[model samples]
Target: MDTATHFAMGFGLAGLAYLDPVVASTPALAGAVMIGTVIGSQAPDLDGLVRLRGTAAYVRNHRGVSHSVPALFLWTGAIFVLIQAIMPQAHWFHLLSWIFLAVCLHVFVDLFNSYGTKGLYPFRDKWVALNAIFIFDPFIFAAHLVGFLLWASGVDPGRSFLLIYIIIAGYYYWRVQVQKRMTELVRQRIGKTGTYTIIPTLSWTNWTFVAKTEHHWYVGELISGEVIILDTFTIKPENERIAAAKKSFKVQSFLAFTHHVHVETKERPFGYEVKWIDLRYRSRFQGKSHYMFVAVVYLDFDLTIRDSFVGWIHRGEDQLAKKLDSNRQLS
Candidate 1:
């Protein structure tokens, strides 16, 4: 998620949680609580890039160390010790207490959906995930929006929005096993027979698999049993990578993603750029190129914009080689 979205969610949580009785009487308390909560929401993301080792990769897929319960306690104690002790004027326990609640609420809210949480800190082996929903679902977002609006209007309803999300997230969580089984069946068939390659399309609602062979791309809705075949995309993983070769795709697989992706280049002496036409469309599901694809790889000597991966070619501007100015007349 982008920083803006995260901040907005944080603000909403803080503003709305004020409506709850525990936080209503004290604005200062709510402020500290909200601060703790929002930070907790993002705390798990710290270990996102850290791969302890290749050994824990499976459970660590989307479910990693940050999502682990150990992580929660680890962070809690750290936060408590740091903030509670550093600020001596305020009662360490008073502030620490609210912050702890805020952090816990943040994690629970994230627990629902397929991106499960490691709720049981030291004992639980599996994660608590509501697989029915996608990690970034618009529907879930809509619900949050409503909650935020209601909270803004000085209405907390004494109901914990975080708790509500858990219940709803749980409903979807239960359905994930069915989809998991379906994915396992496909994984087995393709894994052994050497017939197809599966691509995981992490959608907001559910996990969709795109199995590709040499000739066709088999799109299957894991839970819906809806399958479609397309000739553009390769069924095999090898070709699939080639088929989905845009630079944007590469930028997306980050420990975390930020929406404000901007590219800038400085003016240089003897600015030079070389570009060409190799036609390519957005969706190459079919295994054939219709002379409409082009890869314009340009070499720029300027350090200001050395190796910018221009994911798209609109008209005349090469994504990287083009001057950074938006109003400099499209040439």
Candidate 2:
């Protein structure tokens, strides 16, 4: 989820806290709980500070260990102590419990989106992306807004958010089933030799998918349950250039964050340009399609990395080239 949606979810969780009888009656505790919920909701994303170091660091760390099982309890305990010191009148157990729930819900909802968290880290390093929901879901955000409006209009906050959450729960189930159906459609068309990654778009009936078979890769679109292959690439054995490009930290970080990775190498005037793309996301600009997440590495004739970048490319190769040129540093 995006930052705004996460903050909205925090307020939604605070509203749900009204279900507690003790919290409902005490204004001081209710205020304390709201603060705790908001903080706990945004805590795991503290890894976002890595962006200050660089995109490579951000890619390698954001939502990695911070969203793990151990970080959940750490966030809860830390927030509880902070809020407790501020509001000594607040119930210790209730404050701790609500903060815990807030952090848990934050990680749980993140699993539904395309950019998933490493929630099972230490136990497993795999990224758990359900690909069911977009990062910023309007329906979920609107529900929280409606709950706030209803509460301001004299409606019971507890009952209002409870019903909202129930509906949201149902919405999640429907989205998950829709993703499953899209995956099935891709499998039925592709014959299911290898793995398929289906990514949902804003439209309910539209999706993007990548199918990796033993010999080739299939990139396509799913429209109204129909599978349309837009492009196909043969899976080639890794050569020396590809191995050399992976030595760059930018390339390594990009590869670490993506599952359906596709590498392309091109000869350049000075050296070679190796581009690593995550096939999971596809975008269209002016009717032409483009891969979204990418890492570009410039290697010399001797395979030494000279310059590199790991991030999204929006405007196209022209703009990207300009960016790389402006930042290029020779080793």
- Winning model by lDDT: 2
lDDT string for model 1 (1-331, tens) is: 3333345455555655655565667666666656665775566566655445321233244445565666667776676666545443254455555555545655665565434566664577555643344455554566667777666686663365665466546745654555566556665644533333222234533344444444543444433444433323433232222223223222233212211111212233433222222211213324432222223222234212222232333433333235333234222
Best by TM-score: 2
Instruction: Give the runs in model 2 whose Cα sits over 4 Å from its true position.
Output: 326-331
TM-scores, all candidates, are 0.47, 0.96
Model 2: per-residue Cα lDDT over 244-327, one tens digit each:
999988888888888788889998877888888888777777777788789998888999888888998887676678767833
Q: Considering summed lDDT, which 10 consecutive residues are worst modelled in model 1? A: 255-264
The TM-score of candidate 1 is: 0.47
**Candidate 1: segments with Cα more than 4 A from true spot:** 1-22, 48-63, 85-131, 160-167, 170-207, 210-219, 222-225, 229-331
Model 1, residue 160: distance off in Å is 7.1
